[model samples]
Target: MKRQRNRGRVTLASIAAMCAVAALPGQAHAADDPAPYAFDPEAATVRGTETNAEASELKSGSVYRSAIKPGQKLYYRLNLDDDTNAYVSAVAVPPSGGKVAYGDGITVSIRDVDDTQCGSEDAIFGSGEFARPIAAYAHRVIEKGNSTCREAGEYNVLIERKSNATSSPDEWDLELRYASEPAVKAADAQETEAPENWSSASPVPPSGGQKRSGGSSFYEATGLETGEWHDTIVPGQTRFYRVPVDWGQQIFATAALSNNPKSTEYLGNALSLSLDNPVQGHVDDTTLSYSGEPASVALDPLPPVDYRNRFASASDVSAMRFAGWYYLSVTLSPEVAKSYGDEAIQLRLKVNVRNDPKASPYEGAAGIFGVSDEDKDMAKSGQSAPQAAQSDTMKLVAAAGIGAGAVLVLGLGAWTLLARRRTAPAAVPAAAGGQQPPYGGPTRTW
Candidate 1:
């Protein structure tokens, strides 16, 4: 029988609900088909930003879904401290089959309230980036005695469309994620630079996803079991996949993101690799500029997961501290945008899930908010005890507490080629809980 999964059609409310489900403890499934997928955290409907909002008015760390007309502009205000590192990610979800010639040009910039340009990037969706959505990301670190955007009280994140040829009249979704990373202290700075002890799991899981075509979306993540997985992705796109790791298992993943050899252009090493855990947001992430070469992300096995209080790590890797379906997300920077014309770039993943004695395994009966209640009780008693069997709700809650699926049909008009289901499956959902784990909610500066 075909495995049943969430048809991943999502709304912000659904995402919020899924985020709630993510907080619940896991329940066991009785050898049933795979539950339908989860909701999308980034798919929130946004308020108007066609005009710049004040720093106090603009929200941070949450995905704001909005749209602008051609030649229009959107502005967001940011307030920062000297010790805070600011991050801004702009996602442009293109319409199906829009004939974009020069690409829907996007210009994003950062400026202090006095209008000093701190940073700027022109992200043009080239005709070559036809299959998937694109994103524009910018970052700034407030430093001591910095000349530009110094002692930032408020800054502006500006986004503008440089062309109107390809986009539809309906406002396309413009989702932005703004965050502040804590700066390293002088005492700990040296220790922070220490290299990680990379380890590999023997006999990786023997499952892989189907070959990625030009049209895969983040929603329809190919399911990957532990093992070596392979696929190709377009530059200027981020792809998502799901791997179910139970309570006692440790997960490890590595990816080799390489440039297209046929192209003679300079491809910047703009490859981004990371992992998102079940409850916590991005746990670990790294960006390597690919100036036409290859780069890799080698993720180590997470500390054994327990549904209770989690041990903290980096934003991208810490979320995996729990046992559940973890998301392995890969996004390509557009340095290769000009080099590869509609050609998919290649990627290989080495995924390993192993049993760990140190971590609490999901094999036990689930408890409150994803914390097995029995574990909580054991912690209280200072001894392990027997618990009842897990119910069906545990399975439902573990799978983002989603309902069943329905047929999602595409319009048969001019965009038939773009509406192919053979394209990307719908994306899995995560409540990008503000910053990272050890924090239950998303870290928006509201």
Candidate 2:
């Protein structure tokens, strides 16, 4: 609620995941747990909805500020060169209060300029514990695959507000982004480093940023450094943060959900934490759900980078051939949000970025949003580019792993990971002199 907004459960996949994570070296002075996250409001959003052009032409590598009215839809056209893949995303702000049905929330899809559907996907939500004042993200990818709508041309992306929305339609803010990935080199597609996934989340100096109340949107994500971060989320809501995972540094993170009986009862498998690579691809996702116990997901650290790497794998962290601002996504479904205490669910997010921070691979390139210019050129080739290669085969996909009671299921192929277990992430010792996070706030008397 502080910085712009700022801000888990486990499901069945925890059981299927092997918990053999190697312990990180013991910390001497570093706090293992994340202190409350700090907040900073950066970059005013540029609105793109003033002109409701369904075919408003958009460049392939850019982020747009846009909004939609009730039952209204906004469209942007992207011109893609043959052999290149396209990645696009839309983040929508959730209105506060009321029952939000999962089936009719947000839908994003790609089509030709004339409106023939190339491919489309709907967005879904988990239960929530509160009335809702959060945000959700929807993404779609048009790869250079041999599919129906993958060829070069002007493609339109539609951001639609379904008639099924229970709350009155308000002007919703949307952050839209699209990246064009060039083709990859044949040699790089075969070049990959498969080291044993590192398991240590050793304590370190707290990175910058003071605790912020709400970072529930792309425009409001709390800025995260190399240390652990702390925030709270209501069910049916999703919180997003921007992490500076510089090139050459490997980043490891975990989400620890409070296990109070009242909280745990409705939280079974409702927790999920995911890492989105620089281009917003859902590469590494860890999910768990349980009816009677606390839940956590230990995301293996991402390895350092090089241009010679394949972009596809069970874990997308290591698949990064280049580096920029990677987004960290945490979600608690609507069903889970409904039962969370009125105050919201408390969470300790442990993040460890090994190696020092450096400039992003795309920092000085053509773009400023971290979608590198070099990557876009390589996208034309289709194999060497990280986002482009995946574009050929996968759409911008969302991961889902739902838990029933204590049962764990690996139902979502794109969202599942071959995770080995480590102890719950909160095991880190607190930094010296730091105090437990304050749970009370200023009294509001009318």
Candidate 3:
């Protein structure tokens, strides 16, 4: 019976492939350009309301998709208990090549029924003045004897987009996430503070590793481990990758832009690399000017992940309080296209995650606060979520070809080859230069 079912699947797949190939000749090929943002396909669509009375309810441990026009204030509702720490993050993605000012960005805040603010955060375009995805999160922490925002029954999440006259008037897409972390057991709760000192030395750059494609947004970020990885980025493009950061682990990463000897034009703020914590909180970022020569940017060494880091006054220290997926965003300035052409540039990442996993003090399940074996496997596979799907699709196509006759199989093979050529990015020649040490700068410690 099992063999019969397998055979039935093969036959159906073969028929589907044949029909697809028959229509391939006249189908228009999609452009190599990716979308400005890749929202999770399974995320629920939500609409935010202007007043709290009509606000949509957001459940914990779920993802939602929404949009906000310029100068609009949207509100969403949340229900919480006194023992769990609730967090709400909003990521705003502006249109590529759109006009933006330095201060243009988004703000998020969490408030109680009495209008007492629990927490608020804002993210901006900064000096780059380029349109890109920016994330900000608001969290409600449950302290033992806190006064404000305590005993939460009903809360409101407020999101607003700040724009100026120079910015684009089009609506910006938003990705919203709500997560709750349970409190530690009473017996396990202990007072802890951020580390006062840590290593300030810059890490050595890694040489080579397997090539992987980066995703366009956090939802589709490629999974990476403690190793060297490589990718290609075109001008005006921003790529995102994620790493599983366990408790007690410290992550150090550096991004290098390969030299382009073919073009020696200088561009300021040509390369940027930014890091965000598990809760989508900004940790640290660095930028470097490019002179058509090899240049790199390295994130300052951060303290190991500790639950008590949240009590620290430093932004960077507090941002590393959670132990989950950490995000890395690398972007190239659009002005590079004017000097170096539209060809993709080589991007090499040197990532080092230190320490071992440690036990948490949560009373129950950690709930997205720690890494699992499956997360490690995904990183080792060196494929993004989308790429993994593509691989499965190709395997199914091959199986279908084998089940079909020789004539149909030959046609399918030709179609596969053509599709690859159409989708692959054009390769640029390697820069002829010796290894250059990371651009020297003041060492920072948090």
Candidate 4:
């Protein structure tokens, strides 16, 4: 029979709920997902500057730096220093060579202009319609440009308030709204790739849907509380959640998470899992786990988790570049469960997460094993058992090495292409006599 497996679908709410389930009883395991918030915490830093047209020159005056990923939706808020009737337009330029990509055509008129309306508003702009005469705002998505900006480079947020008189104080402030990295593709897995191989199992024992033993409860609840969701999650911490299964019963597992509406949050990095017990598998190394511990497995580089359907693409899974609940279905063996129980077995729960503490909706790790409740209980205590010593540091080093190697490979490939182009043979021009020669230069003189 075709081996049944857990499928992955991404959802912010599901991620949160998975952590909550890990906290529930029957499996006294602690959530290890929240450790990042406690360790390296991040906060949103808002900075602003005011410019006057009299002193600000167009070249330098109309530019500022914004940290953003490609395809991220940004809402530009325009505030003109002077309220003279003017037309305002925004453009996003790549800082490398100041290459303009998007936002070039969007222009709004304070008055008289029929194209778009800004009306009698002093300042402020965006998507929401203005109740009273308010300022103007526009949203735009970043588009393809110089490759330099594709990775790390400067970008310009430009605003021009067109008025007969040039010295219109076109003060511009940007709200970097809805910024996110695009979902990395399988081909791009080596660089800035998302974890497509990683997938969440459907909530086992489907909620309110007649609970089946290890059926869908693994992903039923799809939300989580903010502030260190799991107390046990710590840096360099690794543990397993084993869900035992009956001889013929099928099961699945999924990661559960949620973000508070109060603030926007994102899940990133090499969130992964392993079968049985991986001894030396690096996130970048692709070692297909047919059986045995996770050893030197080369993982596909894919985009991090986002609130969406959680399924690693076909290529990603084929490349063995992800870690998710389905991994348990592949690695866990029924024989191993003899020590714990006799039913189903879900094994290998691992994740590396870091969150911005100030953001609402706590972040933590949770694993939902798809197995009969009785079998889950048998393996519960053992499942939560701490990973072998130094697993955290080792995993970190491995991940870093894989990243470094990928970058190196990409850089080398780029350099090789450049070198080949430079060394390629150049076309020879015909001689003045109109006859091509092996050595065209001064051939006649000889």
lDDT of 2 by residue, 1-446 (tens): 12112111343233322221111111112122222221112223444432335356666666666667767766676777655556676655445444445444566777765666754544434342222222232233333333566567677677776645465556655666677654444554444444344444544534542343324444444456555465666655556666655456666777767665664464444766766666554446566574535667776555664343333343354345456656677766556645654346666676666776444433134242333444334322212222232343233111222222222233222123311112222333443587532324322223
- TM-score against truth, every candidate: 0.43, 0.50, 0.80, 0.17
Residue-level lDDT of model 1, residues 1-446, one tens digit each, is 11122224434435665665455422222211122222244456655466565322345555555665667777777777755556566656555444343456566677777778775655564434332345555556443445667674877888887655554554555656665443333543323221234343444434554442211323344445556666676655566665556655666777776655665565444566656554223455445555446666676455444432222334323344345445566656544556665456677776776764343332333221133444333322222111111233346544543332212233223235544432322322333774333333333343
Give the root-mean-square deviation of each candidate in angstroms. Answer: 22.9, 25.5, 20.4, 27.4
Q: Each candidate: what lDDT?
A: 0.50, 0.50, 0.80, 0.25
For model 4, what is the C-alpha lDDT against the true structure?
Answer: 0.25
In model 3, what are the clashing residue pairs, if there are any?
none
* lDDT over C-alpha atoms for residue 203 of model 4: 28
lDDT of 3 by residue, 306-361 (tens): 88788889888888888888999998888888998887888999898887788876
For candidate 2, give the lDDT of residue 407: 27
Order of the predicted models by TM-score, top scorer first: 3, 2, 1, 4
Relative to the true structure, candidate 3 has a C-alpha RMSD (angstroms) of 20.4
Task: Kindly report which residue stretches of model 1 are placed more than 4 angstroms away from their true locations once superposed.
Answer: 1-44, 53-56, 164-170, 188-226, 230-239, 242-446
Ranking by lDDT: 3, 1, 2, 4
Among all candidates shown, the one with the greatest TM-score: 3
